[model samples]
Target: MAMRVVDAAAAAIAALLGFVLALPFCLAAPSITTHGSDGGGGSYVSAVGDPGMRRDGLHVAWEAWNFCNEVGREAPGMGSPRGADCFDLENGVDENGQPTYKVVHRVTDADNNLRAGDPLPGSPANITDVDLYAAAKELYLGDRCQVPDSPSPWQFWMVMLKNGNLDTTAAICPENGRPARPFSQTSRFPCPGGAGCMNQPLVFHNRTALDATGRRLRGGLFGTYDLDAADLGSKEVSYYSVTWEKDLGSGGWVFHHKLRTAPKYPWLMLYLRSDATKGFSGGYHYDTRGMTKMVPESPNFKVRVTLEVKQGGGPNSQFYLMDMGSCWKNDGRPCDGDTATDVTRYSEMIINPETPSWCTRRRIEECPPWHTFRNGTRVHRTDAARFPYAAYHVYCSPGNARAAEQPTTYCDAYSNPQPQEILQLVPHPVWGEFGYPTAKGQGWIGDPRTWELDVGALSQALYFYQDPGTPPAKRKWSSLDVGTEIYVSKYAEAEWTLSGFDIVVPEDCVGSSQGGPLVPEFLILCDETLILEIPNQRVPISRGEEEQGKVTHTHEGCLEEVAAGEHLVGGRELAEIPDPAPDLGDAVAAGAQHDEHGGGDRLDHDGAAPALGAVDGEQREASERRAEEQHEHQRRLRGQQREEQLDHGCGGESVDPSNRWWARRRRRKWGRRDVGSGGISRRAIWGDGIRSSRSESSRRIHNGRLLEAVLGASSF
Candidate 1:
């Protein structure tokens, strides 16, 4: 009887949610047209600086990594395995009255060839460790590619390369961010010939220059994982390359990528990422730089891309047509570099036809508990007849999650420096509502199409875990990418081209209005004038006009009832704002409660209930301990500096090794699990009927930012 009641309530909420979202779907239907404006004025603006990669000037970079995301040792002569091709184009008329472009490359071979132990320009000559040198090199390249803009400066498109060979005997990778002890290798995790298996790749770069026509710009980066191989063109070695080109004044740049794997290095990954320009990007512990200037939050952004997959990497290839990544703690606070408590949340759509779904009716743990359809109707994984098992590839719970569903497989603990959660989906009819491929091979090899996906609507509907009674985490995605993970397979190769990549968000939803109500009114703000016109009032408000009035109106298309206190901005109706709160809380509550139940019922590797409680309490203690350590280190450093100055008279202050040790220690502490923030609760704007005083919003954000700054400074 209780189960029946829960089902009935869920059905009712789904219906209500469907009614609220129907009209919005109609208003912003997906279109292939590049321009959103009709020559008249419009509100839409591209969130990316180089939207569609159409700009004449190109900014692109590449970074290579060993098994643990660190550069354990530099390639023989290839520097730190970080290189870039950023250039500007100067246009002029030729003698034949045709257009001509002269390319100006910013990064030179000298900059790219600075090996690990080499001195960097404009910096003290003491920083020489391979991993630290690579981090510094990326920053150097970013400076050469930065484009200063309104909100924030932006960097180049990042081409990331990674190898999945782990030398377990090395004990290099931390165990879920803790100090790891060496162990014997397991078959599931590969380590072919153990020693030197985790070496960095050899790199090659083709600087961007004028094409034969002198009207096009082109460049590329290619290399191999087989460090000892003499010939890159030989067929027996693992290899990868990305060649990008753009017409002088035409459409987006096309990035063609090809990756091949050999028997020794069978598992590899390559991705073109639009990472955040500042702050920590997905899966990265340090501060970073990249293309996305304004991060896109969930349920309010759209992603567009043009992909053509010529070859799939055999059956093991997981080709992500679209992959989104974000970071947040289990208890709904943003990540502040605490690896133990911070979880990397990722969602990917594997378009490879060979990838089969591991999520089935009988394997509920491999699936998110429920699937929410377009019309708000949700079916649990146990509903064999109604659940679309074919739509999911697999769902892996976080390794540190104590409350994960039974039989759930934890993600690979060694891949990332921190615990991670992943949800991989495949093509199916159920995804059609979000403009995704509805069937297998819909956008594969021969069926390439320019996709304008309604990512926000779809992501909002998906199920991600959180503890019960905790405020929901704001899904502010920091990395939007497209690429492939060719799982262990010998002699397998994949080729693809990606273009017209972009992420778009509603103007009002970003920045200041992050926590504001979702107003349905057509808010036209021109020349300092803010016009809020209801749907009934189609009359256009002229620019530079100020007016304040109230009017009653009704839209028969919208059927959801507005709860009390949810008043329109101005009058009878502000333009029936899509139900400010779509009643989808029943689903969230049910999902979250299930997580708590799992925590109590499940056992950790050490046979105990994991430390899932006292989130804020423990985090506060961690923060204070971090602060005390910082003061102690600073005081000791000051005394040492004074002693050096007095003893040596005029010696330059040297960089401290203690500082680096402090960073590693902090990373280890973060690996120890500090879940939530210090009692910071701002009414999370979810469909649930939860509310909080507006007074706490500013204080909470301020403290979050302050703590983030403190943690960052303390580490560096």
Candidate 2:
């Protein structure tokens, strides 16, 4: 009798609210075309699955690491250090014509709570070892959260937490990728409590759900490295939290991050990363999965993000505005899961004003061998007056570089699975051309701003070592992130919010199995003024003016004409592209130009110049297309081979390709959509809700607000 009444009451409430449950689906399931070339002739495509992070349904995950970028041991009851939160939003109309929504989650608490000894669903067998289990679990979670898309399926954004305590006496980490024996405790590596100091954190998740307002989604992961602490709010306890929230109908998701350090865990690092969907990423030797649908290569990609630093972590905080990581051999080959041969390379821009530059003339070993200016000029560290010493914080060479210059500081040997190289930068006039901060405190704290960093150009200009006779390695970055590393600072706190994050690369550069251009034609609404804000410029389009025949826009002193019905957005015009730098041979000669300044002998191991140079236009284009085709073919073959080898159930049982799981993966691997002659309509470009009849005043107001939200008030 009581059950009947309760069921009747629930039905009544459901009917009153007009609540309708929709079938579970991923965000933007019916793929709309997203790749295009602007009218100004710059062709580009999003490198990430969720461009600008504007999708209402979100996909994100979390992972924790010890000092050496691995799961040392799991905390008390906290499973294998990997977890995910992925969900889709369902919309419905209420009885009063008001809107209603529901969050349909893809992953559950049971999946997240699986411990090291537990079996992974699609693994070859149950893994009992903690480190190997964590790596396998990450792959399992990635499968659960994977989103089907063109080119390939992608996983989630990674929120990575790392405890920097190192127990040298335990000898768990390798030295320069070689096995290390136990040693006495040293003050150099922080291990406040000795033996178990490198344990993983206690992670707690708040599954995403409709907030009290019913119009917003909210969720978070919060916990402490100091697992014994009873209260997270206490100053002595290390705590970290990353919470996400977004309104239902519009705007991008904002990730709120807070990290605090305690005495015992003084060196802690937290970052939000866009890692490669497959293969090794950054310092990890295991196969990793993440949001970067296409790994971005140096000299061809740009990173756009909106960051607001609310509280500076402190003087000891190494706040990286942008951090890029990749792995390659010193001999110019790609890494193939060999820890002994692979080397991780990292470049970061530290925005903390209090951080001092350590690459001064007095500390010559801390500086890179050479610095390249935006105008293609080169200067060696020995050319003290010409070299911008203040631009660099510190540069450490890889431990295994056979021909590394004398008086160089090798990077910390035990902090990564393999040898590593690091280039740390500080704000100075030298970096202004890359859209980086021109001075200290530009984007720190109260000066929060949206940064459109030309990471490709900057990285191309930066110096990275290669073997003397080898071809330069392709700088394909597998991980790009932003965060703070509170280095040996106790009771310190850092707070920030990140949004509108995106990685963009040239459309033609991205591989297409079909061997055809991936450009999409875009249509503009009849008389609407479309305003597009790209990296360094704003294009205001008034269709009425365009119909007068040709639309002309000036970019970098060059005039580009756009025909009617065509539009431009999201990329730089061709004329804005600077000439490619000289070949590595020429760069070596240029470096030698300053030989009289006592840097002559350092050029011996600089290697062949980077693969950057200009050639006759038509020939260069054709050659590049052919090279890309060959590379894509090889890449596909490798991918298929890997897939076949790893396709098995938990008990090492092979699963048929006809199974639903395999079918989904196969269906998602189709190439990009062929370009259509008719072009994409305005509705396709901006989605359906925008009204064509909105008043000019109203549209102007809306555009202003959007610019302010994305670029901050300074954009005006």
Candidate 3:
């Protein structure tokens, strides 16, 4: 009798130990599910630090550019044209116990006022060039507003203002990334004033401040490219402003933008951009910084935003509903900042109703060589009847492309710092699948709506040029923006408001390949209960087996519920298991299924499975059998407990064996009723097998050893 009792105890311990070890692996697995308006199955996460612009504390910056996207010279007393408004909100209770909040600023006015010849923190000494100073100032300001996150840290959103007046006579702008000589100016190049036409704007800052109610925070940066203008309100002078406001703890920050063009600065561009946190952003050669923490790749990301255009700038206003920017060589390799060799690639959807498509049958050069449909069908520009010309505004090839097909319109050589290719789209039925505007006036002036754009799918289908016979470049977008560029128009005004902006990409696209943790540690104790342990919070995940052939778990206030029929366990999907006795082998098979679904099996830094494959085939089989026995034991234990409850009518105290076992262990280990510090302890049984205490020489003992020990003890 004594031997039998000891054997039963040993079996119980082994069963619980196996469950504890398997929980983390199951939860850490990647699952597939549709996200946003893009109907696709994949694990998604926000690519930005402040997803949807919902954070009360805001981080935003501003930059001014010349014709070729560089600052030729700073406006007098306007610093480097790089500025930031970043702050944190402190929540506290007053003496009356009423909530009190204080706004704490990060980047000060002094920081924003630093200019050329002024020493900047973290910048190279003796750097006095106007363009280099602006670039360094942007990096300096980004460091001030940086937010720490997994995978990498992120900075602020960018408000980009550009003066499009290129002084061809002065040779200020480069021609296809090469030095240019003086040439006679013409109507093709808009420079109403001769020299110094591509000068920076005079920037004015209205530092963010709280209102009397203390529940609202507002701030803005406004200026004009007309440096000599005495009055900003004057209609003859160009003006631009981007103001942000948000109600504390409710809704997203609304960015209100206004841009006006004048005769001197007839062609002006203003945009709210989300640039990469590191590396060169589109149209830029220097290392840049902005809100995009995880730069989204093509075919696996989506953009969500709410836009209201109060007034369109003019008929010449090229209003971009969405503009994506990336850089690569014609040979399909990533750009290495070699301006002469690198080519900037841009694709944008122009929502202006009056904007006509230049891609007519007669203008084959304005159209791409080929158009790809959502269904993978291809139609050449020559196929007039089948090609959707109305869907495209124009397609321009890079100037330096050696193998561009015949009848191609090379983009303006002086517009960007490098040779560039541009694909401009218009409202058409072909783009309806991506949730873009399908008609001329769908989201124009009077139509204000929230847009969830399938930018990924559309970008993948769009035509971009590459040298023939070269491998395709990975189309990873480094810059995303929305706004309008008033093309050589005088006294034109554009007003708009943007909110709820976000870029979402598959969670696996983030840190999986980088060997960073996909998510916080989670442990699903039993098949029925899941306890997710994030830093400083414990969220319960309830299992729902209501629908047949489907298993769902809803995480309260933590994450979106798994889609129907998707057996997601700990952020990963599991293969369907038999009802009566689900074997541990199914979990192992699920790991393989995850690799087939989308993202490959989770890997450690050195690209190896930490614990899943550690158990040999024979050991895995034994573990599966022991897991089945444990399931049977739990079922019997629950049945006996229910019977006792019915017989004695016991209400208060629980009789579940697992509960009693945990309770006894809790008291013995810590002399307390609760778990240690509300988080998993180092000594606790977790993923990657049991992690030993810090003092132990061996950091981890594999699950194979654990199974061997459990089986050996059970044999007694």
Candidate 4:
């Protein structure tokens, strides 16, 4: 007889960390249901504002950058290179009792068009430095899209674009965050004739709008690094565009992204990131806003994603199927943004079949000291027979380590605000145990499948550097994303679509039986459809049923209620997660609105402010009328009530085995509901398989030290 698991070791760990454990169907009704993780009679409560991307209202933002991730200069007429598309969906029954809806946009074109050094309309003054201005603008947009929730409010999914050409002579980027001396050009990095090569891109946005039938919502952002080009239609220029669309009530939003590389601009990066709602994320130094309100720690959280890659950028493209990032100090403590002391850590699974492993038998330095197996066995790099060298593409140590291991490759010193450590992986059989791609071309073009990755389990087994004899650092990840980094791929284009992305964490972090915070809750997600099917043979039958040639009828399967925290000895494997998009190009010749020298004509600033006097009365009248028309249109778009039934996207579906087993005991029903903002129960599980607790704060106490104390001293 198959033992129906209501209590599993993994599920209990996930429950304490806010993972949704499915209970059996409790009623005889044709309906869907959502369950809360707080141990109350189950009710659905989404951990994110737009659960499963199934909401008509959308919140998404975009940011562009130069070689060192800073706004060295702004493009002409385009403000700080940051923009957002945030809106609400209004629904009502028409005269015929059919649903009618409208898109209400919150951010205006004028607001998104503000350039650096320009004063914000009707707002207090802020720092005018180019880099500082862009950061502030991000915060401003976050305020507009912020959705209040239990742990904290959330903003939007970040679409990040970056150009990777550095003008060595400019010395704009520091070495490990410390000022660097100007150096001559080297073949390792590229530059197109020095001057104006580091300028930002010309960005364009299409506000989210309804289709003719008002049954679909669509919008996009498109532009290029070649500022002088007429538009994306112009030839010989690098370009990028991301379009988002959704059918009314069909499922989840679908993001389609396209990136083209140019000869001059050969290396670029683009990614859709789910960052911490209010804290420093991965490589960034400033506090950022994003979809994850509760960050997930390693060994407790998992991710679910669906990705389809259309065009790989030749052999040089390092397309990340799943990329995760976090920050910490050398002493095994969380990072507090001290550039000199903090180190950014990254792990990426590169799925390109052409990408080869740099860690070979002769290149011990390129490999981590040890390889860990799922069963808790560790093999040294010297143990080539046991060590899975092909499992790793390369491992780079942080540049700031004092006592370094010999022959190790240090990460690029100038790519981020601080020193960094990076681990890149290629597809191999070793990863199969974690639900990752077992071979090449598994999820590449023409072969798309939804993945439910055991990210927590895999990350726990991966090797990371730490100071000798120091306590192990808490593996709390602040940023998780997917996409591609086309390293110097001249004239290549990469395209793809990403949907059904999410991270799942536990509901609470009360002390666990194992003496750590991790507790698992069984979550089984069937691809495409939400229905979870367990075969009857997998369930146990009563003794009397054997004599009658049939089991005591429950439905089709047997129901078993085991004690919580027991191991799920026999069950099918769960699925994994996914990432999105491709790379930016080389820093091609770009246009900077302002003159490089002090004596040239100023593009925007004038000697005197225009007077509000009677001069040019007719012109002033025309301007006023135009402004009034624009205002009227905006008012009409936003005039409706804010609340309505949520139109859910089709993704982020997970089921807990034990929880669903209990659900089967009675008649419970679930209908569509708004993805509202509110405080979560202490036991609120994220949908993506990552573990998180609403009651837990970011300032976690570790080994007699406080993470908050470190945060307080940092620039954030």
Each model's lDDT: 0.61, 0.66, 0.67, 0.60
Please give the clash total of every predicted structure, in order: 3, 1, 3, 84
TM-score per candidate, in order? Answer: 0.68, 0.69, 0.68, 0.66
The clash number for model 1 is 3
Per residue, candidate 1 scores C-alpha lDDT tens digits across 1-716 of 32222232233222322332222211111111111222332244456778888888988888888776778888787778788888888778989997777888888999899878787776677477888888888888888889986456788889999998898988988777666899998876677757888888888898988878787778998989997888777667999999998887787799999999887888899999998877767787667778887776555568999999999888999999999888877766678988888888889999999899999887778887667675545566788999899999999888787666566778877777788888889999999878898888988989888998867667656766665433346566778899999987878899999999988765433222222333222322111111123222211111101111111111111111112112322123222121111111112111212123112232122221111111135654663454455554434433443222111100001111111221222223232111111111122332211122323321111100121110111111
**Per-residue lDDT of model 3, residues 537-647, tens digit only:** 222222121111211222221222122222222233223311111122222222221110111122222221122222336764664565555554533433443222111
lDDT of 4 by residue, 26-118 (tens): 111111121221246433233355666777788999988887778989998788988999998888899999888878788888778877777
Judging by TM-score against the true structure, name the best candidate.
2
Supply the global lDDT for candidate 1: 0.61
Q: What would the per-residue lDDT of candidate 2 be over residues 12-93, giving only the tens digit for each residue?
A: 2222112111111000111211122122445567889999999988999999999999887899988889999999888889
Model 4 scores worst on lDDT over the 10 consecutive residues at 576-585
By TM-score, is 2 or 3 better? Answer: 2
Model 1's TM-score against the true structure? 0.68
- Roughly what TM-score does model 2 have, to 2 decimal places? 0.69
For lDDT, candidate 1 versus 3, the one ahead is 3
Cα lDDT of model 3 overall? 0.67
